[model samples]
Target: MTTPAKPTKNFRFVTGNDPDFFKDKKIVSANRSFVMFQQAKKPCDGIDPLKPQPQRVEKASKRCDASRPQPRTASIPAGAVTETPCPPGMSSDDALGLFRGDRRARKRLVDRPQPNQRVLNQILSLKAEDLPFATPNATDMCSFYALLQTEAAQGVLASRGKLTDGQLLFEAAYEGFMSTFPLRVVGSPHDTFEVLPKFKGDFKSSMEELKCHCSATFSCPNLGRTWIPKATSSKLSFLSTLCISAAHLDAMRGERSIWAPLMGQMIPLLRIMTADRTLNTSDQAIISVLQVLLGTMIACQEVSSNIHWQGLAQLVTLRGGLLQLDPVIAMMISIHSVESSILSESPIVPEYLEFLRQRRERSQPGQPIRYSPLYSNQVELMELRHDPYCSHNTYELLCDIYSLTNLISIMRSPIAELKNFQSLDDMEAERQSICARIACLPSAFSGDSKDLSRRARIVRYRFESCRIAALIYSNAILNGCSFSYAASQITPAFASSVKKDPAPRQNGRNTRSDSLPSIYRNRPVTITSYLKQLLARSDTSGLWGPLSGVLLFVALIGGTAARENLPVPTSATDLGTDSYNVKDRSWMAAVAVRCGVQLGFEYQGTMEKTLVALADVTRMSERCDSAVVEGWRASQEPEILEKSLHDGNGSLGNTSAPQTRFTEATTNEIHIERVSEGWPSTTGQADPSSIDWGFLNGI
Candidate 1:
């Protein structure tokens, strides 16, 4: 071998004996074999065989010497390059060709649409940026926008025609305004009244103003009225509506803000109306204002203690002082009297009874009469006593007066009954017992007879006062002015003494005896007996017994029938603090009788009658037909039990059937058989066939 000639630097050729050439050839064969093996494998194995392998030949032609090196070639342009020959495991024009042909394959992928085209085009189409400039003038722009909104809202409303949501929204807006801007800078009370009509703005303005005003005012009434009829009337109506709205809004919001403002305005108004005589308002007006004020106060959630309830108390005090200034108004004062007592949670019965006691004492020979500013003149205010309207008005007023007085007395009754206990222990026990009794007392008992009686005495004084008030009002209604009549009713003589009794200098013993009733002389009485008597005798006849006769009885016998058998205890100690006050006893008496009678007769009786009627109907149906009776009887067994025991069964009957079975022979049969067959010999054998057990045993 001419030793294979060395190849030049730029030329190479493969020789049959070369190592790289042999390695290349082996790899090519191995790859071909792998292809064939893959092709022969199942299609499920996911391989293709018989693919051609690319032949690796030296850049130089095969005619070159065996040891020649391959020359390097310049890179081919991507587009100019023809497809590479198939490798041993890959076919020409395979999956790679199809992948390369796809134009999108080499381009960048995006998660969303392109910003410049899709998103920007969509945004431009919306024209959102043009909205602000569409209406350039400030006011005009606002107005136009509002109009559009209003139109939109109206369209919605029209679509849902007659729905409550719109109305509710309107109301809420109105309420919010009233709450915020309660007080306006009106010129005067008259101007304040005038401002009320301005609230009815057009729908759009109304809603906006309402929202603004509610934020501004916060529910306080503007108290500017000077008690002029028109002014007062307007203010009252306005405040009433405002209060109602505030309460409603607060309730809806579940807040308590409205109460503070309402109370603030209401208290001052009540005090001004009650105390201001220069205002020259009628008793009806005064009472009406007071009533409304009180109702509002009660309905409010929070109340301020700063308001002068004490002043209100003095205004309604029956015996003397402020209430005495006007008799017709005094009658109206009874309404407040009851209200104050109830709000104070004090029993009014004792106070009224004490007044009665004092009155009785004053009528005695040696005792001085108690004087009140109300009874100044010997001549009664003719205007108050006999007015035609007075009777009816007094009736209604008395009902409320007595009702509240009775309620207070009942509420304070536990303290009232404590007076009769002997020891502290006993008193405390009784107190607890009373507390328990009061707890057990029906809510219906609050205004019954006993309670009414304590209230009645006060009512009687009120009635007398009303008689005077009615007389005054009648005079005013009839004559248009009754200053002389009003003055006469409050003249010096009448004001100095409540009753006509000579001062107690003549008979000391008789005066002392007549001062308080015999029963109340030395000891306090049990409240129960006093209450019972009061309940039994609260009618008109009992209340309005002749004054002269009562006076005469007190004078001559030194005891008035009114004080005859009060259950007052012997001493102050006996009358423990817990004993029912006269007021409480009176109230309890009234409530007990009223509730006991009404509820006992109406509710219990009606329920019993209903049950009886049902039973009778059921019985009649069962008895009228045999088949029905049998069916009914059968139904009664389990059906009745089922209905009755629907919730749960109680207990079963004693005679219910046994749940188990047992079998056994009697001893008498064996004896009888033995006797019939002749007795067996002791220790001796007996014939087995000789036994007559079957016949003897009667099997």
Candidate 2:
């Protein structure tokens, strides 16, 4: 070592500076004992250690360890690819197939398919019972959040390991929430924001967006005639602020965290305050709590009425219904409550329904009948005498839905870019008007005795079920989102509002209204329970009448929507009182299957086609084939006829193919043909990755 070779620059210890690309790729030797990282210099058959020297250079045999027996050597091929290594594991064809993403690779690596195929093939359920509720995963110490912190806040986060300027993050997140999913009320502009009160003077407040330079501010109606009151934004407390921030984190990054100690402390304080009957909850505090609840729902991406909604309902009940609250607060509760009810299959809130009824009575004084150009045909549905099979208010709601659907369809076309409609305000007003109609109409029959034929009663019952199904259609297909938003803060507070006395407290909790069902005594009624009661009588054989198709649609929707981690009892004795009590996916699918068979549909493809059409949430402009023009022709009744109805250029029905594919459980050879109406029968799905969902936003 002392005689250490005076370092020659060329005589480095490592043979090459650049490591081989395939150096890490492990390959087994012939005996599978030794592993080698060697490239094939030339392709050949096998090795023969004792062979006589040949005239030509010998070929490189398959890699082998000392433990393997040798075979006859073969002549090296001049330009053969690294031949299938004779290690006897993994063929050349198989290696090539893996490199080039193919079905073969997918089959071999069942758990890990090729990247693109792998991602899309996963069956992600929208609503699963077993999927854990969204909880905060991030912490104050996370460097990711440090990016959002101020210098002072960053120092606090570093040294103290606490987030003090969380409001800054919350404000930023509120802006994002407003931009991403601004839940608009009726009479409001599309994709608008909740305006904050930027005070110009003492005791003077206007609907001016504060210093926030958010995109939602640009879209928001800044000055005169705002629908959402400024009070909503102004009253949000730090608790609500953190919640909104958490929701933003949940939506954008799929990661969430909150000030856990603060929350824990606040919960105890809230409990103590709640226990104190003298300490009445103010409107602002209630509003903040509502925001907190709403934020949690958003964070969870909730599509059903779970615990949050139940608590919210109870709080609203304590507050003497939506009317007694500030107008804007009422609107917030109404929108969330109504939409959640529709989604969860719960009964419409009585307060909202009564409010709509009063509005109807008030507007009846001078308002003239008006119909959208696309759905003048549904005007008759408004009259109880027009169709005994239809409920007057529900059918009226359905009629408006059709109009709204057509208007939205037209608005989504290129023609909308030209600004053909009166204005987005008018459209939203129309939608709000529809929301009010949904509120006014009962989701199911009153179960009151009526003078009608046996079949007529059955038909009317089916029609009621169809209305709720249509609500689902509107919530999912039309909105392209689970949440529905309606009711205007500007809607004048009703004079004779329901005023309930504060519930008498006993043993630390307030006594609930005794009139309500026992379900609400514990928790609010779920839509599943309501549906079961609604369908109790319809267990007999009877056509859903003219609305039979709609019933099928509803059944399909219920089945799909109810796909959750439900426990199925294998033994009959274990079938508890709850067994078959809930009309779950199994029940719903059975209903659909039976209906399909009764309707003479022999192919499972028919059901598949129906499900696809139900989920076709694309904009009409993007979906239409060779959409040269927004195809609407003049008609006397409705004033506009969809050219797709008459197959102009290419049928609009062709445009309604689903963006995603669902592999059918059963595929039948049977064909039952009768041209689809505004439904796909001739088109295939779009590329799953290319789906654009911007149409969901009204703007």
Candidate 3:
């Protein structure tokens, strides 16, 4: 502008060279001189080539200058832009465009599936108290068929959703039934699902609906009807048909879609069926139903939660009691046993024992017992009296008793006698055989009959009983206690010789006195005396030594008694009167002395010892009576007189003390002195009124 300033290399004005340059600057110099002058006057003018301006000061001044000018901003025209939401049924892209055109309409539409109007409408239209029962109509059948198809489709879709959404469907179905058919819903779908089989596809929805119906039926108790009976009958009819239809359909599809719903319906239907007696008429069907029910109940979570033995027991006892349902009951008991065994610290051992005891008691004699109750009770009674089963039961019972100390003692008591002695003869023989086997043993086996370590105590008592019986019977025979002839016939030679030996007097020791033969006297004396002494030192210690001594003594005594050639005493008084009565008659004396010694020992020992000793003594006395009777009969003695003495002696042994002596003077006054002194007391005193022995033994 200053003389149209000559074009300058550093300062040239060119149009459209830089668009921002025109906007930034108001004018440009054409000449370099003028440009220099203008630049010099400006604050950005360079004073020297190396010098530079402070950017902070320049920026601050520019900002201050800009602040001085009025603030400006671009304005949007009203017609230039707008926002509008698409129509209600429009796509999202259309709505987005509408939103861009008209902003106010953006809030109108939200993307969400329409409420399941069909299912809701179906539920809303359903009338209370009018459940959808099967009808012989095309329209109703078609609607049900269509509903089934729709449910199957919905279930497929729902299966693809989150598990939480699937659960929501179940809950929604339950709620719908609760709201529409309040009379048909029972407890809760959650509870039902715990017991029901997991259904798939549309069947899952159907199950939910079924559960809802059952719950509704049971909910209204005031409807003049029991829901259990009605529901059971209806379900029985419905499920039977449904199962058949499903089976047919599954056959065609080669799939088991109905299996889930069928299983799901089984438990509740079973409860219904069991509730009505009429529904149980078909034996095979009932059994099948029960089987299915049992399987379901066993598999159910609710069963685990609600399990109780008493309920199971009640079920077993129903209808015909345990006898009629023993198989089922046994299965249940077995299950309980296993469970109790697993969970309990000390399982129900006593209960098992009680069961065995009751079974044994109820069993009759001589019947073929069946393990299975399906057989006649008569068969069981037959078997109970004989053979393998009775013995088997006895063994099992014994094992159970052995497990408990208290039970062992109870079973061991004499009160536990066999119901019939004849019937138990084989068992007794077996027991005796076992005892004999043990006796023959050189050492105690690991499985000894005795339960405690102090076995000698038991053996000692048993040996004492045997000795006492032998002594009493031999004395009665030798003393001629009205049965001398009988005694002579029955007494063995060795026992007779021993009984006739003279007494070893208390006077100056007679080394070679005119006593009985040494063989007869010393051997019996040595053995019996050793046993008595060993038994006298009665302590649990040195058990084997004492037991061995007793066993040896018993063997010698039994061997001598069995020889069958021993002499016999003439009368009871002969036993007391002879100078050798204390020695020749010492066998009886030894018996009495041992009895007294045992009593005294027991009095000094424990209560258990005393009781055991008493029992041993009682058993000995009984055996004595039996032996005396045998000896009397074999000798052809006066039956009446012999019976009296034998019976009297037995009674006396039981009631009187061993230390109580019968004086000779009193014995003679009572006409028993001779017998008491080793002569037959009734040798010369014949009573005509006495019965003859010839007729007694069928002679």
Candidate 4:
């Protein structure tokens, strides 16, 4: 049927080649298709192409799913920043204030403050009866050492798992020990002497363990997860290093490993804080505490390095100036500056003076704070006494000492860079002013004997010794020997030569031996007698007083004076014509040396070396004196005289006889011998037991 319908020519498909297709076709075309459709059409398709079909529409569903709620995001305004608000119970402003030293917000977080909850918790963990003995006390010499060891062990174990917990525990233990320990009992013979060395060992060992735990926790790979940040770790290391070095300061003598590492860490952090010039009370408190601790070390000569001094001083200025420093630290720094100036013969006083002036200027206008009100009973118990003459306390006395010593220091400088004293006349006026101030101080021995405690006695001794040293050194400077050179040259070996002539007496002042310009030079016997008295009293006082540092300097001065050719005192207050021999003076110097050794400055080897050299020189002088007498007798011999007269020869018969210049020749020989022989080892060679340090050990 389909084939039958296709027989029609109009219905059949035809190609362009069909004769009828071209004959019937017109050139006209249907209306143009859409340009979009035409342009998108395939090349295979002719000019016309099919249009795109519309997408199919789907009906909306009425069912709802109620399990999940859509998120409600408020539209952010253009150019507006979005931030999360602070949670309830915390003020955003207060939280922000913390960086500026606002403590109110943080104080609220601490539930308890009075009893130091952390310290209380630690104390509760230990046996209650052992609490009194945890620190060194009158009753227990080596108290709390066993407890400290236990704490250290537990800390090490906990540090491996929870580092912050271990650190807190160790800090608690150290604080406990520091709070309880009475440092006065350390060198007191009334307590036990044998216990000190043991206690020191235990203390050092505990500090070492703490340091190890800190290092381990910090170096661990997962430190990021731990509670202690890098900054906290560094703080702990600094504290640990400080404690260890302080405990062993007598022997450490500025060991770089003991101090440098911790200082290195602290300096950078301090620099950052100082550079920003931000007011942070916490940082100020930290620096103040550090100053006290480090100043203590300096006072004890435990640290001789000035590496951090200038930097620390600048930091202190930025914090709140010198007045902001803790009272104990201030006192110690003053003492340290004086001692350093004297020893080095340089004036650190000018810079220190500027610091003080700035502090005074910054202080509020009120009655000047003579002593810091924030006193620590545990730390400054020994310095707590009041001196009525100064109207305040020992602090004023320290200020007085600093003032006088500062002037002396300036005077001693070759250039004398002081504005008040530019010439020798100006120096003399300033010197008189200082001498008057010293004279105004009541005699150290004037106090009633019955009222003196062990600490009082030490204070008295220290004051007297410092006063003596000032007088001696000042006079030496006036005599044309620079104070800087005098300190070193005043050693017993050189004193005799340095003072070939008698020191000039102060103008119109002879009320007492102490008032004399050159007390050591003019009245050796008087000074030695008083020093001997001090030594004898210390021997019986049941306290080991070696005159540490400043005190030792005083003793050395006395010893040096004892070697000079000066007459002994005929009466208690009067100098006499009768003089002690060289051998006797040497013995006197030996006494001073022995006293110095008792105080533990023996490691310095200064006093010991000076005494030994002085003794050798004394013996040489005695030998020369004997040879002189023999030569005089030989000259009187008739046969030798006649032979010399007849021969007209200037040469003597004997070549071995000493001449009048024997003393000078022997002095040169003595120095040469010392160099060649390498000088006898002073510190290590001597056996502590054999040297009769029994006085130090005795009760």
My TM-score estimates for the predictions, one after another, are 0.20, 0.27, 0.19, 0.28
Clashing pairs in 4: 546-599
**Highest TM-score, which number?**
4
List candidate 4 stretches off by more than 4 Å. 1-165, 168-282, 285-305, 316-345, 349-351, 355-471, 480-484, 491-699
Best-first order by TM-score: 4, 2, 1, 3
Worst 10 residues of 2 by lDDT: 483-492
How far off is residue 7 in model 4, in Å? Answer: 99
Model 3 whole-model lDDT (C-alpha atoms): 0.31
Candidate 3 stretches greater than 4 Å from native: 1-307, 326-328, 334-699
From the highest lDDT down, the ranking of the candidates is 2, 4, 3, 1
lDDT of 2 by residue, 162-184 (tens): 33333223322332211111222
How does each model score on lDDT? 0.29, 0.35, 0.31, 0.34
The model with the greater lDDT, 3 or 4, is 4
- Per-residue alpha-carbon lDDT of candidate 4 for residues 316-364, written as tens digits (9 for 90 to 100): 6655765675543343344333333333233345544343323322233
lDDT per residue, candidate 1, 1-699, as tens digits?
566333332221222334454455333433333434434434455565433332322222232323656454443322222233323442223333443463334444743322222222222233211211011222211221232234444454465345344232322222221111222223333233223322221212222343333333232221122212322343333344344334333432334355345544555455554555643244333444443443333332113211333444444453254425443233223323332332232233333223222221113365322211122122322222343322333444333322322332333356755554465444333333322221121211222223344444433333333222222222111111221211121111111111222335355432223322222222232222232222223332222222211111111111011111222212212422333332232232222222212222222222122222222222222222233222322333666656656767523332221111011113211111111122221121222211111111110
Q: Model 1 — TM-score against the truth? A: 0.20
The local distance difference test score of model 4 is 0.34
Candidate number with greatest lDDT: 2
Q: In angstroms, how far off is 6's CA in candidate 3?
A: 89
**Model 1 misplacement above 4 A:** 1-254, 257-277, 280-285, 288-296, 299-306, 311-699
